[model samples]
Target: MMVDDRAGRPATSSGSEGHVLSTPTLLGDRYQLGEVIGSGGMADVYLAKDQLLGREVAVKVLRDPEPDPTDRARFMSEARTLAGLNHPHLVTLLDAGTSADRPFLVMELVRGTNLGEATRRGGPVPPQRMAEVGAQVAEALAYVHEAGVVHRDVKPGNVLLREDRRVLLADFGIARLVNDTAHHTRVGTTIGSPAYFSPEQVQGLTVTPASDVYSLGLVLLEALTGERAYGGTPTEAAMARLNRNPEIPSTLPAGWVTLLQAMTDPEPTRRPDAQHVLERLRALAGGDDAAATQLANATQVAGATQMMTSVPPAAARPEPTTSVPRAEEPAQKRKRPYWAIAVGIVLVAAVIVALVLLGDRGATVPDVPDDVPSQLRDPLQDLHDSVEEAGQ
Candidate 1:
């Protein structure tokens, strides 16, 4: 039987409502809750300060009491899975314990937004930024895979970006420890975001590291194209994964397109592992640098070609008149026309302007106010005064 929660129905276990504790305040003594950061059907995350460490941290608390044996087992498994991971690109699990009647996890508080929010507001990031993020995430996955864990829920919403722009994979609540199959049997249904789920996950097959890579490919595709690789409603996102092929974005870089295609291959055996993906992305980034250099060289060659073509041909001299006869037929000297001179001057000026524009292409120019002197003790005083006046 299922019981209806705030959103809808969820699998229910036999437990009294009194067993679930109400919200308790433990701010300054243990963790100081700043505000609610996020909430979902299963848990709510809060921005808090860890009094013990004197640093900010995020606390995620289960929505209901873990009195039920099944729920308690699953919660314990999650804690064990997180405790086993120690990677720079993964959110550090600081502490986990039962507070009051709810099970809670303390994690590193990321200052920046999640990938989902970033992509929605800024569209796709630059290729270089995407590659950097992808590489870090791949490395994080590799580390976790080596530890014999499979992250069943890898998606954009679960990937956090730190203030320094580093990627931190979050939400290992559903991750299964390799030896915890007994606990996994209790968690009845799939626990991953539909849009980024691997095909095997949709088919109810056991998840592996390659499954993580498949999901990572979906995330990378979204990061590069500002759109989901599969088209469907939110509820249908998982169903779409069962299809043979996902649509590739037309605007993605050639190398990235190839990488994503390999990652999202339907057959888990055919898909590349996290380590392989990391190496490929690193190589792609290096190749991009070389390609940029080649483009610059090509542009220079084209400019040189244009300059050579524009040069006037060598002046042709009439054959020397061996015979100095026929003085009457004096050679009429053609005067250089004023219009020709004007045209030449205009061409030279245009070339100078073009060169100036090209030189400024990659240069950063500072903006100065008209009232500011070229050199002064406080040239910015007028600007400050203007700002103050505007505020007034």
Candidate 2:
């Protein structure tokens, strides 16, 4: 039998291996640590199960050399910030407490891969998919912004893609509560990914929603192009963000170009708000304008062809006789003209009916004149007659 140090399962210890930290029988006797998920400068994240709730969660424990009074306060404040935010796209903070002299945050366990891993494994995502991801993240940011929180780090690694392909924004580690103590980010201390950091963040200024939008644009760019919009190295990345323009990929959807441009605008004020981004995404996804037009044209052509094939030939009418009794001849002659006119009118009506039926089959009909030419205006005239008959 072998023991897994991370899972805290009992196992045979090998003398050759270094001693592992004894798994504490109790993490405040509440959360049962499972496996290490990830570690960052401030904390180590673990897959944990909450014994009380019998539910899986992510536990992020502060690193050793516990945070100073000020840091601890800030950490607690972050927990409060997460507690206040109620959004589907954000990771929900379930609980927070001090355990073994370390502050830990129990968060909703988000299954599936992060954007970074997905991008690395599969090339750039499709433009439509990228738009979807961006829109979702933007909505999350919008919610946090409304709560007066600024997520200082909005990079690909913090964005997770779930099994159902929903985008979830995670790891709000460096996020700051706007109403809290005034703490300006130190200059030259790069907080977010250089490739995705906005110019304002690079300048060590207080980050805003616009900064998040700028970072999201970079993520979108990478997702669409399958490569960083800036450069390879950190230094190059920073410089690119500061001085270079993002190269628009030819494969990107035309409607989305404006959206990307607005997102990556150097001037924060010029950028579109999250609400606007959401609207645009909805429009694209629901197949508005361009898509609808294309579909209408396609259906119209098919309808016209189908109508021509299904219509029955006009029924033959008996021809009026020329000869009759002398006395009745005059009456018959008079009736002949009337019968001829009625037959002509019936033939015209039949053509109109055929055209209207064809038009009703999804073909767009042109406007009809009051005295339309018999040969050139059947389709439009037929539509008018059908409408008039329906009203009657």
* Poorly placed runs, candidate 1 (over 4 Å): 1-24, 27-29, 65-68, 185-188, 287-392
What's the TM-score of every candidate structure? 0.65, 0.65
State the C-alpha lDDT per candidate. 0.63, 0.63
What pairs collide in candidate 1? none
lDDT, candidate 2, at 172: 74
Cα lDDT for residue 228, candidate 2: 84
Residue 127 alpha-carbon offset, candidate 1, angstroms: 2.1
Question: Which stretches of model 2 miss by more than 4 angstroms?
Answer: 1-25, 68-71, 184-188, 289-392
Model 1: per-residue Cα lDDT over 180-210, one tens digit each? 5465444455566788888778766666777
The Cα error of candidate 1 at residue 345, in Å, is: 83
Which candidate's TM-score is highest?
2
Instruction: Go through the candidates in order and give the C-alpha RMSD of each one to the true structure.
Output: 27.6, 27.8
